[model samples]
Target: MADPAADAVVRQMRDAIMDTDLKLLQAVNTRLELVARLRAYKRSQGMDFVDQAREDWMHRYLAASNRGPLSEEGLHEIYGRLLDLTKAETAEDDPAG
Candidate 1:
């Protein structure tokens, strides 16, 4: 037996979260698409896809830019996963691999 007002509040919060989740999904897909294009350009130039220095720079840059309720560790965790996912997606687009 939930209070009606509380239930409405919960529903409203859930709806907002769902909208944000959809935005995140869209952003990730857009990033993957850009990664695919970069992979193609690298392939044309015979360049290696894995750039460790660039990745390190990216993590540092993101950490510096973050002004957040999210901790540095949390930012690292999320971006680390994103980097892995991006690498995997780019690899999948590689014809030579």
Candidate 2:
């Protein structure tokens, strides 16, 4: 049988990882909420959602936001995925309008 202490340690690590994931989920949710607001504001301005300038700005923002824990590429990838999802969401709203 596996050592009891080792099993306990694994459980502790798993719990910590879950807690971190929950926090990340909350942060991502907040970011998505902001994206939705941005979509609304753009609509008000008679502007399209897919703005190259905005994407460039996001790249610069992400570049400037480089901190420890996540590499720049990883950060970009995460935001890229978020942007993709945001675009899809906005597109859905458009087809129905």
Candidate 3:
């Protein structure tokens, strides 16, 4: 049999985690919307959507800002995935692509 108190604590923690997940989803959507706008602006300026220098700068910024339970490698992995997703999302939305 489980301790009722422990079960209650676990439920609370799970709820908190779910809330954080929802917030992360909201943030991702917001970022995607901004990416769409950026794509349009860049298109008007006759520029490519993929900017390697900007991505490098972002990685450095995130590395500097991270005070993490997540290691550097973990951060890189996550950001790399994010960049890939962002590019894919932008490409899908891009009319020219």
Candidate 4:
């Protein structure tokens, strides 16, 4: 049975979810910009921008801090994708890009 009121509530929640998605997109872009700037500064200082130890620490820290319905695999996937996006957005280091 299709209830109109339930449909309305679902529609409202979907709209809010879509808005959150837009915010995520904006956040990723902001992160990418900041990473690019940091990478440039590190390059000038004769240093490597991508720190493997820091990345490992971040994953551990986030996993410990997370408290939600989000699964461990989902969190790892999102974190990996975020790192990949930031790295791909920055140039000079990746010759293939």
Candidate 5:
């Protein structure tokens, strides 16, 4: 049962998976930076940074845009968590936070 060829394939697949994970992290960081800039502008304009309608539209847009293997429910869960993470991250950056 020692298929050396299969083992090598699996090893390469894992490396690709790790690279994808790093790309995802980098994308999240980039999104976070954009969000921080938006927040700063909103603050300067005396506008609320949290936009419920925009968030709702984003969820709907992402659901419509997703072509998957990934279920709609899974996307929803991950997106919800990402939104929460964004808020938590921005909060930590606040001086009064």
Candidate 6:
């Protein structure tokens, strides 16, 4: 029962959201590549693969910067997943892993 013009507008909005999702994916991939480069450098220097202190620092940073309906805990949990994924990718790229 939707009007044709309204339907077209909805489709355009959906496409725009999809493009935004793609951009987010691209940004994540770019960050992962940077993590890989860091891993390579650390490996060459015989450094550890995991840095718990840095991860903790990120948790603190995100928690302090959170300013939304989402609780700081919620932000930490979501960002924790991202950090874990990044760590896993970096670990996989590490020569020691």
Best by TM-score: 3
Question: Would you list the clashing residue pairs of candidate 1?
Answer: none
- Can you give the lDDT of residue 55 in candidate 5? 98
lDDT of 5: 0.89
| lDDT by residue for model 2 (1-97), tens | 8876579888898899999999988987787777777778888888777788979798888878787588888888887888887777655656423
lDDT of 4 by residue, 34-63 (tens): 888888888888788789999999998898
Candidate 5 Cα errors over 4 Å, as ranges: 1-6
TM-score of 2: 0.72
Alpha-carbon runs more than 4 Å astray in model 1: 1-6
Per-model TM-score versus the true fold:
0.89, 0.72, 0.91, 0.84, 0.90, 0.76
lDDT of 5 by residue, 3-52 (tens): 76569888898889999999999999998998888887787788888999
lDDT of 6 by residue, 2-71 (tens): 7765698888988999999999899999999988898888888888767999889988987888888899
lDDT of 1: 0.91
Indicate the worst ten consecutive residues by lDDT in candidate 1.
88-97
Cα lDDT computed for each candidate against the true fold: 0.91, 0.79, 0.91, 0.84, 0.89, 0.85
Cα lDDT tens digits, model 1, 1-97, are: 8876579888898899999999999999999999899889988999987799999999999999999988999999999999899888778768786
Angstrom error at residue 25, model 5: 0.6
Candidate 5 C-alpha error for residue 34, in Å: 0.7
Give residue 25's error in model 2 in angstroms.
1.7
Which of the numbered candidates is closest to the native, going by highest lDDT? 3
TM-score: model 1 vs. ground truth: 0.89
- TM-score, cand. 6 vs. native: 0.76
